[model samples]
Each structure stands twice: as structure tokens, then as C-alpha cells.
Target: MATSWNGLSSVLPEESYMTLITALAFTVLWLLWSISSYFRCRNRLPLPPGNFGFPVIGQTVEHLLALRTADGIRQWMQKQVDKHGPVFRYRFVGYPMVMMSQPEGNKFIFQNEGLSNHIFWPSHISTMFGPHAVITQSGERHKLVRCHLNRFFDRAAMGRYIHGVNCNAIRHFTNHWQGKEQLVALDIINFFTGSCVCNLALSLEEGPLMYRILEETQTWIGGLYCLPINLPGFRYYKALKARGSIFKLLDGLMEQRRQMIAEDHVPEALQNDILNSLLTVPDEEGNLRQDSFIKDNLLILLFGGYDTSSVTLAMTIFYIAKNPHVYEQILQEQKLIVDGKCSSGENENALTMEDISAMKYTWGAIQETLRLHPVLTGSYRKTVTDLEYEGYHIPKGWLLNWNSQHSHYNPKYFKDPFKFDPSRWEKRPPPFTYLPFGGGVHLCLGYEFARMEMLIFIHHLVRNFSWSLVDPSYDGPIIRDPLPRTKDRVLINVKRVIAS
Candidate 1:
């Protein structure tokens, strides 16, 4: 085959041409060596059954490709599961790794965080979230950060958080949604989640700075889930640029927060936010948490709330339309909440913690959405020491991941697994079999926060308007803007409802 560089070689000086050829040769040789190393240790241990495909890239291309199709990851994983059972080995991005799809594997990874396994994040996640984030930390540091952050994130803080969330949802809908007859749901939902996280986590109101952060956040998310290749024209490069800008904005805010705490002049608006509390709140040792630690956790909340909430809620839009039964039931549930206010002569329509708590069927649909359309495919852990399970040997330092495909979609754990059945949530699935928010100490800190954000927005949505898909015939994979969304914009028509 003729090289694309055929004409370039003729124009180049002879010595330069030879040097270029040498460089190309060296690149090929290095890749060959790197790929060989992944196979060398395989013969030494009973590493689970799998193959290392291609050189350097390994199975990464396949993984990326599967992401483009609906139910692709689970489908791809199922093929390997059929051939290799619950435990299997595969290579991605030059790393030899193992993936498990059984509840046993999920339980083991969660329950043994510091012993058999330790937290590990892939390149894209760690880079985007930063090094000091608790999710990226392991051992004592992880516990330390978790303990400090828990004071603000635990159930006790819910009262302080919900009021702002409630206020924001009402304001957001009034300003952004009420007047529009048709709009892109992805853009609308992303804006709502991003703004809420920033306000609750950083005490920003609707303004230029908050909107700027939200804009950059949009850029950062584009690369969050893609392969971590950093070259130009790649999504990860643009994401890094976005992170730089967002951190600069956050750093300026943090300094102001630090000064406010020092002066002992906390504004009522800022008092409830996690930023104000983190800057002044003492830890178990009576020491204020470090700046980097606070910033990292805040970044985590931003990513966690925006990514997962947007995905689950977007899927909720899809599923509600696809399954009309769910929509009717959810609307029925929401209308009753509206009626409760009228009966009590409450003189207000804002959703409260009590109102959200009453959304049993709606929460069920949310759970069902999370199960079928998780923002993340799974979690990754690194072996702390050489380990053996199911009579297979795993040398220390091998990358391992636990995916929920087998457990979440298996007929044993969920009847007619592919079908969207919110009623199935009435009785919880077996332990460790359903973990959309994960579990153990490593569970997402924003779990409750995300839940509340979703409930409040959904409550407003179903109660205030009736919606229909602008393009009902379309069905395709949810594109990843660092999380699941429709490939084509999911536009919906809404006509505001007057209360009965």
C-alpha cells in the first residue's frame, strides 16, 4: 500500500526522511514490547480466562465502540461472561485487568476496601476529579476526608440543603421552562442540575459567575467518560482546558470563603452551603480541613450531582414515554401532592421534604431508570495484595472492576430484566445485586442530594405540565456527554397546566 506520506518523503531532505523512518520503526518496536509484557505474567498465574487483543490499545476500541450502541456494554460483557463465566480478564489502554459481573464480586469489592482491595480510578476520572478528591484517596486519607465531609453531607444537613433546592427548582422552572412550548430536555436538565450543585455546594445564586462555571462544566463533561487520550481534536484535551478554568473560578471563591470564616461574618445565604461549613468546620481532631481537601470534595459534588442526576432524569424522560403506565402512575402520585396543599389551605405550592418523601412511585421509577441506565458502567478497584477467589489467582497490582450487568439485568435478581418495571422496586432486590449509587463507605456522597434534586424537579415537571416527545419514533443509544443522553436532542413539547 502506498503511504499517505509518499509525496512528503520526496520533498524532505534524505537525512530527515531516514530519521522519520527510524522514529516510526522505534514506535512499532515499543508497542510490540509493551503488548508482550501483558502476556508474560499470564503464564505464571491462573489469571481468569480472557485475551489481550491487539498492541497497546488492547480491547479499548471495542469498549469505546460498544458505548455507541444501546445496551452495548452489558451485551459485550455478556459475551465474555458466556465464554469465561463471572470472572474474566481483558486489556484496556495498556493495562491488563479483570472484570466481574456477579453479586459476590460486588460485595467483595465494597466490603473489603482497605484489605483485599483499595480504591482506584481510571485516568479520565482521576484527572477530571483531581488527586485530592476523597474518591481518589485510599486508606487513612480516604477515611479522613470522608469523615470531614460527612459533617456537611450526612442526613443532618438535609434540612439546610432542601430549602435551597426547593427554592431553586421553582425559580429554575419559572425562568427557564414555564414559557417554552418546546425545548431540548438535555440542555434544560443539565442547566438545572449544574446550577443546583454550584449553589448548594458553593453558595452562588443565579449570576454571571455561576453561569460561567456551568458553561465550563459543560466542556469538562464532554471528555469525562471518553478515553483519556490528550491529543488535540480529542475530547479529553478540551475537558482538561475546561477543568483549569473552573478550578480558577472555584479557587477565587474559596479564598473569599476563607476570609469570611476568619472575620466570623457568615451571610445567611452562605451559611447553609457546604463551602462555608467546610472552611470553618472542625474535624475529629478539631482541625479545619485543608483547602485542597475541601476543593476536591466540592469538585466531586459538582461532577456527581450533574452527571448522575442528568443521566437518570434524562432516562426518566425516555422511560416515561416508552412506558406510558409509569407516566400515568407518576402523574397520579404528583397530583395528589398538589391536592394535599389545596386541602390544607397551605397557600403555597413549593415541594417540601415531606412532599418529596411521599413520592414512592416516582422514586421507584427513578430507581428503575438508574438500574437500566447507570451513569457509570461500574467501579474499579486495585488488588492490595496477591489475591485468589473462585480458585483463580490474581497477582497484586492487577486492575479489577465490578460491573452490575449480571446482577442488575439477570433474570434471577430481576424478573424480565430488560423490561422497565418500577413496581419491582416494592421489594428490594437481593443485597449487592442493585447498586446504582454504589454502597459501603465508598457510596456517592451526593446520593441523597441527587435524589432530592431529581424528585423536586420531577415533581414540578409532571404536576405543572403534560409533555410529549417531539420525535416519538426515534430510539437510539443515549450519547455520553460524560454521561448518558440522547444522540439527537430529546425535544419535548410542554403546555403548562392550571391547577385543578
Candidate 2:
């Protein structure tokens, strides 16, 4: 039976009918107001011009596809530059963003970070890390957490873990690489780094729990690229589940660490790991950090150690294998360090803070690798205020993206951009021009730790082995594991060389 509007109204009470009409009228009025406000803004302040192409799924597929190769993102973003100039608008997975690719813009973003703009992580990531996690915080809360985190990367803290990194490399090569001739380099690197994080950071020995944490991390990481939909059969859903499982598992370990602290029985070797230190020591104010802070950041430390170190370390190996001249220089550099230790009768193969510092060329090579093949090309920030940038109205709530490729590949900053010259790093590039580890306050807290870890890995790799790329001519088609990586397995033929 088709009911008229009057008939429907009659079926309900008069008061109820009036309430429904009022709700509909309010919704329609609100929509009208919103649409009028949008157009008003459009008339008054123009958005930077560029085609985002379709809503909700705008430009994401194309963006992801472009990032699947080495130099692909640079080229893709360049096309946008060629057409729309450096500062322009685009939609990434429905997020409307303006790409700021100048040193001045980079400076503006970082300088005004807590004032005009702030760190912008999606709700899914914030949800996964918990609301209190460092990645999600800003202003004073972020400062408090960051101050607590400083203890983990101090010189003394790094000194404590130097030998462990060396030990992990030796064990990895012995257990996994000794017999293998041809293998995927990244896979080997990932496992080695995973063990380093587990053993050195989490205080987990080579056991079932260690493997379980690493496995769960993989699932958790997969969710970074997923939409934040909490439904059955979604990657984000699986990622959330994985995050819960990891947190639950970490809860038990945190308890163990607490018990160890209470008993005052932490071994000297175990003292270096961040968790033990975080659990036992008071912060600058002499208060122990929150349990949830320790717990969530354990997730940060473990994953940060792997994702940052593994790819760049692998790329260092990749570039070294592909470029013989570069490899020769690195080999010569590492040889001298080893020779000095042997001459002095120090533990001949032992790596120390001094040894890591002396690795200038090798470190330069890692830096060059980072510049050419950044794990993340850029990061997202949010505007806290409406502002003018490069003559564009970047309204608040829109994302602001600053890409490194702008400076890394810009000839104005680099003499011969796109060339893999480690010597360029001998002198630091101008401010905001080279941001492999990013720059300013948010400049990767893991920077020094990553540097030390990579230097040690290279020292062992160069001194103990020689390798060749499976595809010598392949530059790359960098794939994204939520970060840029070699699309090819980065297959290589590696062989053991002279022991120290």
C-alpha cells in the first residue's frame, strides 16, 4: 500500500511527525550551510590548482603504482611539478594535500611545527599505537614523551649495544649466509635486523616468543597501507588484531622486566636493551614513565630498529655489489679499521663506539644510499592555522606533505642530482636539502642508533664477504612495503672472504 506523506504523518503521533520534520529540516539546512561555506571559501581563497581525479580513492592507485620502482616517485612527482609547478594540490587516498618541495617550505613547516602545523598521523595509526603513543602526541605531551625517549639514544646507551650489533651480524652470517651462494639479500637482512631488535632492544633471546613477536610485527606493519575500516576481511582489522596480540604478549614481557627491576637482578649484557632501561630508571623528573608508554614504545623501538636499518643496510650492500669502484673504496676503508684493531691487539673483530665513529667513508656510503633510496620519501603534517605558502591558501585540516626528492634530486642543492656519489656527503648539504632521516625536531629520534647499527653491519659485511647483484644492470623498480624497497628480490651471489 502506497501511503501519502499526510497518511504517514497520521500513522505517527503529531508530536513525533513534527520532530521528524524538524530533524530533516535541520539536516538540509546544515548541508546548505556547509556547501555555501565551501563555495564562499572557494570564491575568497583559491586552492592550489591540480587535478585529484575522483573522490575518496583519488590518485592513490596511481601514486602507489608509481612508487613501485626506483626513481619512479621522483619522476611521478616531477610530472606534477612540470605541469603544476612545485607547490600544488593532490589527493592521496582521499586526503587533500599540498606538496611543499622547497627548503623554505620545509623550514616553515618544521619551524612552525607546534605553532602553525603539527604532526599528522591518521586515526588508524593513532588507534594502533594507542592515544598515548609518541607518534600520536603533539606540543607538551610530545615533549614529555620525547624527553623520556632521549635516554635510549644517548652515547652511553649506544655504547652498551655496540658489541651486540657486531655479535648479531656474526651470528647471522654464520647461521644463515655461510653456505648459501645465491639468496635474496633483503630477506637475510630483515631476519638479521629482527634478531638484533629482539635480542638487543626487547631482551628476547632466540626462542619461540621472539619469533612470534617478529611474525606479529609483519601483520601489524601490513595495516599501515590499509584503510582504517574495522570490518571482517580487512587488513586494518587484521592489523588491529595483530596489534592487540602483540600488546598482550608485550604485557607479559613488561611484567618480566618489572620483576627483574624489582629484584635488581638485570645482567650487565641485558642492561643495554631499551626496555630494561626504560622500566627501571626514572625520567629527568625522577618519575618512572607510564606503563602504557613503555609498552607502546617497545613496539616503536622494535619496529623502528628493523624498518629503518634493514632496507638502507640492504641497499648499501646492493649499491656496493653493483658499483665495483664504490665497493673498492668501501672495502679499502673497512680494511684499514680492521687492520688498526689487529695491530693494537684489541679483540681483532670487535666493534666499538670509536670504531663506528671512524667509519667515515662507509657511513658516507650509507648516507648516499639513504639519499637515493629513502625508506619514506616524505611525511605528512597538518596545519593548525590557515596560512599562506608560496602564494597558496593552505586551509587548516588539509594535509601538508614535504618530499625529500625535491631537494635530494634538485640540481640547485646537489651538483649532479640523481648520481650516486658518496663523496657528496663528505660535506653536509645545505639546510633542508638532504633529509634522509628527516630534519628538525621530528628528525628521526632513531637517527644516531640507525647510523651506528648500519655502520656496524657494513663493517662486518665489507670485511667478511664479497657479493654481486643477480641483475647487475637493474637500477630498481622500488616497491613499497609501506616504504620504498627494491621490487626485485634484490637477488645476489655472496661468498665468505678472509676472517679477521
Candidate 3:
């Protein structure tokens, strides 16, 4: 039908023009392919299946944003798991990532001695936290730092510091509540937890500068959890600056501690806080690590320990206040302790390790809060070598993630997964079923310390006052990220509960 030259050109294009265009396109594609192929070949481990996006960025941004919510990304992952079984590959950013989700898979990945232990935090994060931070260190160095750090967090260590802890708690509350007409107990709770952790880390009391730094730093880290990018003027950038300023402030504190330790001017009882623990712990070679190592590691503990615990306690308070029955039950339990009729029957207010253990309902409430709103939605890892689990190949050089909420909410794992029922944890859900503090070798170092801190604050607050939502409009589920406060910042009307 197109025998004419014009018709021929319109239908197929001129041969000369088509040939030239095809050659140019082919050459451009070849160059792009070669570059991508080189990177792919260089990083030749069978990565866990993931969404591979545009080559350079891979799936970083997409992965970060998807995981920003509690269960949104996890629900998606569950759908994939349901379709692909326990192990599968999915497109992330633009890269293929293989993931293993079965409990056995988790065990396998966690137990393997040879699996590379590098972290997968963004460049900006690593830069701000410092390269040698124990969280990122690998091999023998990580082991040494972790071993020494564990000493400070163990029961023996914390037990010795109880007086110090009580002092910090009292000071934090008294200072916040002393002269305010309408005190925001939530923020006060936050500051209290922050001060508790600060005392643990640097043995320094929270003051005006420390509070401001804490506030600014919380904004910064909270911003990074959502906006994982570092474009200029971005929320993450501002947060990064805040983080740097906070680090500088911490540096000053660390220097002061070191000087005090050097001069033997520090209190004997409080001298062995995290910073001192690192400074005093000697390696097999009998050599002390430099001040840089001590400072970075202390920052790691301060950041990880305080931030997660404060958010958790805040959320628990939100739940307890909303469900007055739960609050009353906890108070009754506390009273039983006071009346020496605790379950196993212990004195009230003065919780022994046994009493804290017996407070199953309280612990369950914390678990439920964590399950519904994990302080961290996920954790990231980078493979050091090719690995395989649950029939899926995980290649080295790819970033992998453990999506916490999806695991926590999986109906197969927990009954009525979304509801805030603390009873589930009373029975103690299966291992890794509710990982608020993460799992495996990287399980949070400050877990026990956080628990003690939470229990102490909750015990005191529950005893002192009764509170409820102050504003009617503040009624709803808590909002997440960019600061995980209640929708209206958990504005609660407070009244001092008289002791009978």
C-alpha cells in the first residue's frame, strides 16, 4: 500500500537516518551497560532479592521511605513473603535484593560466625556518628569494644549505680516540676529519661545547654529516620548539623570527664560510667584506646540508649493514660508491692529484681507499645560476602534490611497483632517475634539499662500523679517519625494522686 517514497519514509523512516540514529543509541547504551556491568561484576555476590532502581542510587531512597511507617512497608513485604515464601528477591530502589524472613532464616543469618558484620547506614549517618563507633566497627575491634561496653550495662554494674540513678531521676523530676504552673509531663518524662541515660554515659547532670542540645539532636535524628537524603537545605541536612553540634557538646563533656578522671577528682561511685568504662578497659596488649575511640563509642551509647528508651516510655505513657483501666491496674500492682502483696509478694515502690520480674503486666504493656510502635521500624545491614538462606541467594555488596514492624505484626506470629494488648508478651511471644530492641549479635547493648530506666520512671510517675488527655482533639493513634509523639503531642491534664 505504501509504494511511494513519501509513504515509505513515513512508515519505516529513511534507512540512512535510521542507521545513524540506531548506531548512536547503540553506542550510548553500550557505554551505560559497560559501566553498570563493571559495578555489578565487581560486587559479584548473589544479593538478596530487592528492587533495583536506577543504577547509581540503586534502591536506597525507595527502601528508606517505604520503611518510614510502622507497618506499611512490612505489610508489603508480608504480601511478597506470602507469595514467594520465606525467601524472595524484590526490586528495591532499582537493585535486586534477596531477603530471608523465616525465624530459621533469622537464626541462620544471626548465628553464622562468618557472615560479614558491616552496617548499612547512609554515608551521612556514618560521617556524623564517626567511623570507629562500636556499632560500625568490625572483627576484633568491635568485639573488644562490645565486651567492655557490656560490663557497664550488666546487672552488677547497674546495681552499683542505683543510687546515682535514683538521684538523677529525682533531680530531673524536681527540676521540671518545681515551679511550672502547667508542666508538660511528657517532655519532662523525655528529659528525665535523657538525663538518666546521660548520667549513665558521661555522668553529667542535664542542664540548660544539655537540654537544648538534646532537643535539637532529637529533631535531627528523628528527621534522618524519614528523610534519608542529604540534599542541601533538606531536613536531614539540618538534622545532620544539629547532630554535629550535639557531638561537639558531647566532646566537651567527654573531655571534662577525661580530665577529671586524670586528676582523680571524679566521684568514686560514678567514675565508671560508659566513658570511663571504655577509658579504663585495657586490651590484651595492655594498651588503652585513644580518646577518639572513647568519645565515639560514648556517643553511640548516648544516642542509641537514650533516644529509643525515651520514645518507648513516652508511647507507653500514651497507652496507659488512654486506657485508664491499664493505668489503674499498674497502680494496683504497684500498691500490692507497697502493701507487700505483690504477685510473688514484694514491697511496693521498692522493686527488687524479683518485683520488676513479677510486674509481668507492666512489661507486657511495654511490649505492646513496642510492637505497635517500634522506636525503630527497621535495621539495615550490608553483606561482606555472598550468602544464601531459605533458598534465596543473598549477594555481597548489597544493602539488606530487617523490617521490624512487618515481623512484629505478622498474624502468623502474634494474635490480633495490631491491637495494644500487653498480655501477649506476658506469655512471651516466640523469639524474634517482637523485636523492639532488634535481635542477633547486634541486639541493643543498652537493653537492660533501658528497661530499668523505664521501670523507674513509670513507677515514680504512676505513683505521683493521675493524667489524661487535656485536649479533646488529641484523641487518636500516635503519629510517627519526625518526632513520634501523640497526634496533639500527648497533651495530658495532670493531678497529683494522694497517697493513702
lDDT score for candidate 1 against the true structure? 0.81
Residue 91 of model 1, lDDT score: 82
lDDT of 3 by residue, 430-470 (tens): 77666777777677888887877777677667777777766
Q: Write the per-residue lDDT of candidate 1 for residues 1-500, one digit (tens) a residue.
A: 66568788878999999999999999999999988987876655577998888977789879877766547888899999999889998887677788878999888788888898888877777878888988898888888878767766666677667777877887888988888999788778877898888887887777889788888877887776677888988889988988888888989998887788778887877887788877777877899877777767787778787756876887798778778788889989888888888799874466677887899999999999888877766878889798887878888888888887678889999999888899998998899998888776788877877888899888878767777888887677666554667875578887898644
Q: What is the C-alpha lDDT of each candidate?
A: 0.81, 0.80, 0.68
Better of 1 and 2 by TM-score: 1
Sort by lDDT, top down from the best: 1, 2, 3
Q: Which stretches of candidate 2 lie over 4 Å from their true place?
A: 1-46, 229-233, 262-268, 281-291
Question: Cα deviation of 21 in candidate 3 (Å)?
Answer: 37
Worst lDDT window (10 residues) for model 3? 341-350
* Candidate 3 residue-pair clash tally: 33
**True lDDT of residue 188, candidate 3:** 66
Error of 3 at 44 (Å): 14
Sort all candidates by TM-score, best to worst. 1, 2, 3
> After superposition, which runs of candidate 1 have C-alpha atoms over 4 Å from their true positions?
1-45, 282-290, 347-350
**Per-residue lDDT for 126-245 in model 2, tens only?**
777777767777888888788778767778878877777788888888888888898888877887788877886677766789888988887888777656789979988998899889
